[model samples]
Target: MACNKSFSSNYFLLTPEEVGFFDLIHILFSTTKFEEGIKFLDMSKFVSKPLSELGSGIEVALNLIPSNRNVFVFMLNFLRGRAVKPDKTSATFLSFIGLIDKRVELDGSIKHGDANYHAALSAMASKASYENSACIETIVKNHWKMKFLGFYDFWNDYQGKATTQAFLLRDKTCDQDTIVVAFRGTEPFDADAWCTDFDFSWYELYGAGKIHGGFMKALGLHKNDGWPKEEVKQDGKPPRPRAYYAIRDMLNKLLRQNDESRYIVTGHSFGGALAILFPAILAMHDEAWLLERLQGVYTFGQPRVGDEKFGEFMEKQLKEHRVPYFRIVYGNDMVPRLPFDDNALMYKHFGTCLYYNRHYEVKVVEEEPYRNYFSSLGAIPKMINAFWELIRSFTISYAKGPGYKEGWLLRIFRIIGLVIPGAPAHSTQDYVNATRLGSSDVFVPPKDI
Candidate 1:
């Protein structure tokens, strides 16, 4: 496959730029760019939350999703629903998937370049899952308790409030003291966009261009004055405009007040990619070359970073130490599982890899990834959605709302949810007029971008 003119099969697939990743030095030092490098560093890609004029545009998802059940189902469905690209080595196991002729009906359009969109509409609907499920299972299969920390929940802290990132010390009896922090993606669900604790302008220094004026204003740092406005480069080219200092600051904060001890990194989807870079920045800071002390790195839904050579070098570096710094994807999940080989998306030079972690496993949670694709469509038919979607003003809103009940009602509602179908109980929305949610609004996902 190396330097072969014949691509494995697909053409657009070969675009090196398409293979975005987090396994680098500034981006992949294994401790800085990706905080989860040490353990399961679950981040909702915290720092990447869109800082828009209208605020973080999280409402697009809200308007589409009417109830709690739908939201919950959507999250669960999409979490493990990435289509797998067929490979020569493991094609035999695919064995005419039992669910092959069964495709889910879509009430709307599948995202172009979006696998979930393809899975819901394409013939291979039942085959997709998160690329990292098996890898995540292996790392925690033997654990006494698995703690799930939603990366979005850190919004308060990110907004300058407080966080549970270092809450591990609270649990004295917990074994190994390993934690997994999870974050949400842009599709289907809009993760929380509370920019509280961190310096707004500093975070923007990491972003491209003058998009973040509020951030600039907050830090008394201007885009032209301090931050460099450079087009985001996906190749091996370094991000020069944005300084890694913001990321470096977060790392310093994470390990600052605590007695750093046993830790590892883990994340799902985007968080998985961030895991590599978070640690990398930290490694650079450690005068002692602390990167070598890492126990392992296990991320599900991990994406490729940089060119193949970079991925190789990361693998080689980690493998030499018997550490599990490998990106593990399930056989079926199609989140662009890169060639973990030397010519990989990240760590291209050298990497030690074990194809499948024994403990890694996939539990087919759903017969179909999005069974209720029809219901979510509301009135839109699958075929006609193309034109209608454009006409409709795509609105997204996220907020704290009243519950169905305060006492017995909450319990009754919970019970009814089991008996009858439901939507999301918890939700967030955007107010078109205001940059904040309701009157106490602070931030929102960008309307554009």
Candidate 2:
């Protein structure tokens, strides 16, 4: 694909779809570069060397597993029944992650005035974002006693389908009424979503630095045109509405209706990345009205989205807007530790990191201990922590109460952690636990946005 005039000139994008089995093998030996192996990387100012090569390698590796068509078909046939059934919310392999902690009501201990109240609320909303519209509506309206705004599945310009999902809810108490927008994260059975996570493509904005290209596409990045302040009109049939534009319009209407209404964006995993990026785009467009009304941003197990420069830009934007940005990481959860914060990749995490250990101990840090997950020295400790977590699952209920109990499914997942240490730690259950059980002091709420 040729570079569009409006698109960023400096970018490195990889398309795993173009890689054949032989071409996948060619990634390892980069000496004789195969021009047709990966398409998109040949664009002007973007080469298929080293960085894009590494990204292509990662994408190909993921494609060989459940992220491919064959595995997806097998998984769907095996898990399809779960999706159709009323009891099961999703057909994804990790659907059981949401089932581990089924508690819908906010913790009674965390009162409305408590510092952790919004964090706890946001965590539950993030978890609920993974479920279907029916489940979300029931939980919000009946259990939480909140107003269900709407659930949306938005289009991804690059992927050519509606792959992004999010829902909005309004929680009004006697003291305040806040709007919560929760984005759905990667699903295990979704090849497209997995491809998105594995794709390390990036686009460098004029001043914002380099942002993840896959995420930008997922969050309404137009193919030909970069982010124009206003949505571009499509000729012939109107294209599907994107997540950014669509959500922005919805927020404008909602905030206009009530002068006091404020909104916060949140999500888990891939959703978390989108949650933080939502406001960055708002800041880019200089949406003073929405930025002023943006209460805070809370992300759980969010992956690194940009370089150090991008991080600095985001820090300035968030600080100038007076937005409280909280990045929650539970133990060695692997998602937050990527895409590697090394010289080669240059991805970094900024903002306050509320790091929670296995015992739900909270530590406010600039970044998590192990910024990269692939360290040889850290491997043993991560495994030890994983083993301890498995043991803790059985006895956590006795210590914390019945609400903290782990189910058989979660135990099975914990067992898998033995093989892949940080995998189980990325679950929504632990994040929910962190918000509810962890200290409230970590939350730095400014006087007002």
My TM-score estimates for the predictions, one after another, are 0.32, 0.84
Q: Which stretches of candidate 2 lie over 4 Å from their true place?
A: 1-5, 17-94, 446-449
Cα RMSDs, all models: 22.0, 8.1
Show where candidate 1 strays beyond 4 Å.
1-175, 179-260, 283-293, 319-322, 338-449
lDDT of 2 at 6: 49
Candidate 1 structure quality by residue, lDDT tens digits, 66-89 = 222356665665577732323312
TM-score of 1: 0.32
lDDT for 83 (candidate 2): 24
